[model samples]
Target: MTQRYSVLLWLTGGLVVLFLIAPILAIMPLSFNSEPFFTYPMPGLSLRWYEEFFTSNVWLMSLKNSLIVAVCATILATFLGTLAAIGLARKECPVRGLIMAILISPMIVPIVVSAVGIYYAFAAVGLLNSLTGLILAHTALGAPFVLITVSASLAGFDYNLMRAAANLGARPHTATLQIMLPMIAPGVFSGALFAFATSFDEVVVALFLTGSEERTLPKQMWSGVREQLSPTIAAVATMLILLSTLLLIVMLWLQNRAEKQKQRLEG
Candidate 1:
């Protein structure tokens, strides 16, 4: 009965994976379609759409904007989230639970609601339809992932290391940089990857906050879907899929390394 249940579980899991990935895989061939239409059994395969994506001003500009915003947001989110995680990791930190809840609330809240709220708030401050506004909004959304990852890394941390550093006359900043940062680097890196991916793929908030000049890749894709379905969109989607896969690999590697480090420490 247990073996039968295990086989059933495997089959169920495989179906779920197929359901999630089938649509994404279906588009890959369409991206290379020579006839400029998304259809099965393409007339021929060509790199025209990929070429267009690279050369087209609109697509190129949106890609550039996405990179800029994602990079900036990742840096800001990682820094702020790392700090928050450290503070919350402390036993005596005041209102630690409350602060963590507030910090991560953006992740819990509905994105549309958060986007609308951000739009109104930014409009009041004259930051609406701006890159700065988009970066700030994405930072808010991405920080929670960083907080979670970094906090997990801190879970296995030994306070004795910090105490030892202090005993050896190391400054607090020195201890953090030389000791704590090394031990937690994997989590920090994984969190930064998540932050970058979050900002890169975000659409709803980008729609609310970004102007024409500040349009992101996802916003451009949304526009293409609405205005006219193009193979170029498919090409971009394929590229994004590749990028996401690479990030996932890196995150998994980091997680494995962190686990190994933890085991070594414990042993």
Candidate 2:
């Protein structure tokens, strides 16, 4: 009976995975379609759409904007979130739970609601429709993931090591850089990947916050889908899928490394 149940669970899990991935798998082939439309049963396969994406100024600019925004947001989120995590992990930190809840509120709140609020707030300050505004919004959204990951990493941390470093005449900053930073590096990197992916793939907030000049890749894709169903969008989607897969692999590797580090520390 146990064996039968295990097989049934595997089948159910496989179906769920297939359901999630099928659309992504279906679009990849259409990217190479010679025709402009996204329909299947292609007349012939060509890399024309991919070539268009690479060569087109608008698409290239959008790609550049996405890279810039994502990189900036990742760095900001990782730094702020790691600091917040360290503070929250401390036993004597004041109002720790409340502060943590506020920090991560973006993750809990509906994104549309968050976007609307941000739009008005930025508008009041003349920050709307700018790269700075978009980066700030993305940093808010991405920071929670960093906080959660780094906090988990800190859960296994030994505060005694910090004390030992102090006893050995090390400054606090030196201890953090040489000791705590190395231990939590994997989680920090994993969180950075999540933060980058979040900023890169974000659409709704980008639509609300950005002007034409500040458009990101996802924003450009949204415009293409609405204006005309271009096979170029499919090509872009395929490239994004490849990028996401690579990030996912790296995140998994970092997670495994973190686990091994934890085991070593415990042992």
Candidate 3:
């Protein structure tokens, strides 16, 4: 009975994985579809849509903008979130719980609520529709993800090593760079991946805050998706899937490395 149950569980898990991957995989062949419409089992297979995606200035520009925004947001959120996580994890900090709550509140709050507030705030500051404004908003949303990942890593972190580093004449920054950052780097990198994914996939806030000039990939896709359903967007989706897969691989590697580090520390 137990063996039978185990087999059943495996089958169920496989089904779930297939379900999740189906839509993404569907986009792949659809991109090569000779039909302009978004459908499969094409009369012929061609790279026409792929060519369109690459050649179209609007699509190419949006892709560039998305990459820039994701990179910038990832860096900013990872730096700030890693620092904040370290501070929060230290025992000497006062009101650490409160600080952590405040840091993560953005994640808990409804995105629409936050979007409205940011829209108004950016509008007032004359930052609406600007790259900087979009970056700032995405960074704010992405930081909580960084904080969550880094804090998880720090949960198993050693503090005595930090003390030893300090005693060995290492300055605070030096100790952080050599000891702390290395120890927690997997978590930091995982956090950065999440931040990049969040910023890259985000659309609602971008919709509200962005203008024609500063449109990200999702925004461009959104506008085009409504006017006419085309296979070009499917091509973009496949690219996004590939990018997401790469990031996921990076995150998994980091997580496995972190686990090994934890085992070493514990041993």
Candidate 4:
């Protein structure tokens, strides 16, 4: 009976995986279709759409904007969030619980609601329809993920090591940079990936905050969906999928490296 149950569970899991992945797999071939439409059984496979995606000025500009915003947001979020997490991990930190809730509230609140609120707030401050505004908003949305990851990394951290560093005449900042940051690097990097992904793919906030000039890749894709409905969007999607897969591979590698480092440290 147990063996039968185990086999059934395995089959169910495999089916679930297939169900989730099949749609994404289906889209790849459509990107290569020689025709403009998204129909199945392509008449021929061609790189026409890929060529269009690369050659189009609009798509290229949007891609550049996305990279700029994502990279800036990720860097800011990682730095600020790492500091916040380190502070919270300290035993003497005041109002840790309340601070944590406030820090992570952006992730909790509904995205549309946050966008609306940001829209109004930015308008008041004249931050609307600008790359700087968009980057700041993305940083707000992404910092919580960084905080969570770094906090988890700091959970088993050793305060005694900091004291030892101090006793050895190292300054607090020096100890943190030299000793603590190195140990928590995996978490910082993982959080950075999450921040970059969030900033890169965020559409709702982009729609609310940006003008056409500042549009990111997702915004451009949304525009293409509404206005053009071209096969170039499919090619862009395929490229994004490839990029996501690369990021996932890097994350897995980081996780494995972190585990080995942890073991070595513990040993």
Candidate 5:
């Protein structure tokens, strides 16, 4: 009976995973469809869409812009989020709940509303239609994820470790850098990856903040879908799917590593 139940659970989980991933996986073969349309049973396998995706100047530039914004936003978001998380984790921090609510409100708020507000704010500062504006906007959108992950990691941290480091003549910042940061490295990295993914795939903010010169890959994809629905989009989507899968794998590994580290620390 137990064996049957175990088999049923495994099969159920497998089906759920397949259901979630099927749509994404379905696009991969369509990307290689020889005909421009996304029809089943392939007109014949071809690499034309992939070639176009690689060789097109517009596609390349959009990809470049996305990478630049995502990287910059990831760095800024991670730094700010880590500091914010650390502050919030402190028992004595003033109005921690209120402050955290504000910090992570971006995650709860509708992105379109945020983008509209950001657009007006950027316009006032003359930052609209630029990479800088896009980076800043993406940073706001990404920072909450970083904060959440780091805070969860910090939950298991031992304050005594910090005190011991301080007693050894280390400064507060030094202790944080050398001791606390190392222990939470996996969370920090995982959060940064999430931040990068958020920024990389973000489109609404980019649509509002960026111009032709600063168009990111997602914005480009959006435009393509709206204007032409090109098979090149399928190609790009497949590549992005692969990238997303890689990031997911890395996050899972980091989470597992953090669990093992926490066990060791607890033991």
Candidate 6:
């Protein structure tokens, strides 16, 4: 009975995987379809959509804006998140739970609620429809991911190492930069990568905060889909899938490296 159940579980899991991947897999080949609309079996294969995606200034400009926002958000989120993680890892802080809850509150709050609040706030500050404003908004939303990853890494960290460095007359800042930073580098990198991905893919806040000049790739794709169901979006989606897969592989490598380093240090 147990063996039968295990086989059943494996089969069920396989179906779930297929369910999740089938739609995404459908997009790639459909992008190559010569059909004017989204459909199966291209009248013929062509790269016209991809070519359009590359050459169109609207699409290209949105891609550039997305990259800029992602990069800026990654930097800000990583810095702020890493610092918060380090501060929390110190046992001396009172009300650490409260602090952590506050830090991660953004993740728990509904995106729509946050978006509404941010929209009004940015409008008041004249940050609405601006790239800098979009970047800042994304950074705020993405920071929680970085904080979670770094905090998980630091949970296994040895405080004794910090004490040793301090005892050796290394200043706190020096110890952090030279020792702690190196030790947690993998987590930091993974966190930053995740931040970049989150910012790159985000749409809700972008819809609220951005305009024609600052519209991200996702927002542009969204509008295209709404207006005319362009198959060029399928091509863009395929590219995003490829990009996300590459980032995922990098994140997995960083995680594995961090685990190995942790073992070596602990051993």
Model 3's alpha-carbon lDDT is 0.90
Tens digits of per-residue lDDT for model 1, 1-267: 999999999999999999999999899989999997767788998999999999999999999999999999999999999999999999999999899999999999999999999999999999987899999999999999999999999999998999999999999999999999999999999999999999999999999988888899999999999999999999999999999999999999999999999999999
Model 5: per-residue lDDT, tens digit, 158-245? 9999999888999999999999999999999999999999999999999999888998999999999999999999999999999999
In order of TM-score, best first, we have 2, 1, 4, 6, 5, 3
Instruction: Summarize candidate 2's per-residue lDDT along 1-267 as a digit string, tens digits.
Output: 999999999999999999999999999999999887767688898999989999999999999999999999999999999999998999899999999999999999999999999999999999988999999999999999999999999999999999999999999999999999999999999999999999999999999999999999999999998998898999999999999999999999999999998898889
For each candidate, the alpha-carbon lDDT, in order, equals 0.96, 0.95, 0.90, 0.93, 0.95, 0.92
| Backbone Cα, N, C clashes tallied per candidate | 0, 0, 0, 0, 0, 0
Candidate 1, 183: how far from true, in Å? 0.4
Model 5 misses residue 112 by how many Å? Answer: 0.7
Candidate 3 deviation (Cα RMSD): 1.4
Write out the backbone clash pairs for model 5: none
Q: What shift in Å separates residue 113 of candidate 2 from its native position after superposition?
A: 0.6
After superposing candidate 2, which stretches have Cα over 4 Å from the reference?
A: none
- The residue-by-residue lDDT of candidate 6 on 115-212, one tens digit each, is 99999999999999899999999999889889999998998888788899999999999999998888888999999999999999999999999888
Model 2 residue 66 CA deviation in Å: 0.5
Candidate 3 regions exceeding 4 Å error are: none
Superposed model 6: Cα runs more than 4 Å off? none
Q: Mark the 10 consecutive residues where model 5 has the least summed lDDT.
A: 34-43
Give the winner by lDDT: 4 or 5: 5
User: What global local distance difference test value does model 1 have?
Assistant: 0.96
Off by over 4 Å in 1: none
